[model samples]
Target: MRLSGRQIDCIRGGRGVFSGLDFEASSGEVLAVVGPNGSGKTSLLRLIAGLLVPAGGSVALEGGDAELTLPEQAHYLGHRDALKPALSVHENLSFWRDFLGGKTGDVGQCLAAVGLGHATHLPAAFLSAGQRRRLSIARLMVVRRPVWLLDEPTSALDTAGQALFVGVMRDHLAGGGIVIAATHAPLGIETRELRMGSAT
Candidate 1:
């Protein structure tokens, strides 16, 4: 399947962030959105994930599930971890699994995959930034989604944590899943770069 955005436009707070943007991403491919601050990198990903409405243009998926919209088929990992500080790592993940409305996955296995298995009972607020990020990564594994929209995915990760995340992303792509990330750091994988701002 392929995701395409044609002549897209983004306006925020009555000001235009970007306009006439165009791009396409297909299955088993990693699309990296690279741009400086205020260049609308996050805006573009949000548009593709259906979190933001385009002022003009369209985003369509070809050769995919006709019954579900693009956003419904995607897993959006934004800057925030989206976890409840009062809950444990396992609890946070379990909550998302139930809320996202999908077949239940192995939460323990997913936590182990991200190196959070030992911390399953620890409160989310007690974990370090890197550990918290790993918990967020675990959420991606609990529910199967074809499209992954990640913004600064490895922000709080250290060298080892980043390496682990790269493996996770590679496995997803190998499974024919599509990943679209907005990041300033290297993704540790070959990606089709979509540079925004004046160059585009």
Candidate 2:
């Protein structure tokens, strides 16, 4: 599968963020969006995920499910963990699995993969930042989405958690998925860079 964005333009809060930007990623490819702050990295991802409508240009995915739109076939993991503080770890994942209808995996196994098996019953409010991030990773595993748009995916992750996430991403790519990540830190995996703005 191939995802492409052409001549994209973004305007936020009545100010232009970016314009005439283009990007493409295929199956098993990791595209890292990097640049200084306010360069529209997150805006680009949001556009591709269909969260924000582009002022100009278009985003498309080829060789994907014809019945679904690009956003429907993609997973957007933003800076926020998007967890329910009132729910347990497993409950949170279960909610996502049910809400996102697609190929599903075992929630327990996914939690174990992300090192959250021991905290399956723990409320999200009591988990640390790193743990919250791990739980989000587990959410990704439980739902099958071909396109992953990650914004600072490694944030709040410790050394080991970051390393573990690398493996998770690798597994996703090995399964022929595409990852588009906006990050300041290294993803700890080989990726093509899509630098934004004028920063060198």
Best candidate (score: lDDT):
2
Per residue, candidate 1 scores C-alpha lDDT tens digits across 12-82 of 88889988989998999999999889999888888888889999999998877899998998999998889
Q: Specify the poorest-scoring 10-residue window by lDDT in model 1.
A: 191-200
| Per-residue alpha-carbon lDDT of candidate 2 for residues 1-200, written as tens digits (9 for 90 to 100) | 99999998898898889988999999999999999999999989999999999999999999999999999999999988889999998899999999997999999999999998899999999999999999999888999999999999999999999999999999999999999999999999999999898422
lDDT of each: 0.90, 0.93
| Model 2: CA > 4 A from native | 198-200
Best by TM-score: 2
What are the RMSD figures for all models against the true structure? 1.3, 1.4
List pairs with backbone clashes in candidate 2. Answer: none
TM-score of each: 0.96, 0.98
The whole-model C-alpha lDDT of candidate 2 against the native structure comes to 0.93
Alpha carbon deviation, residue 169, candidate 2 (Å): 0.6
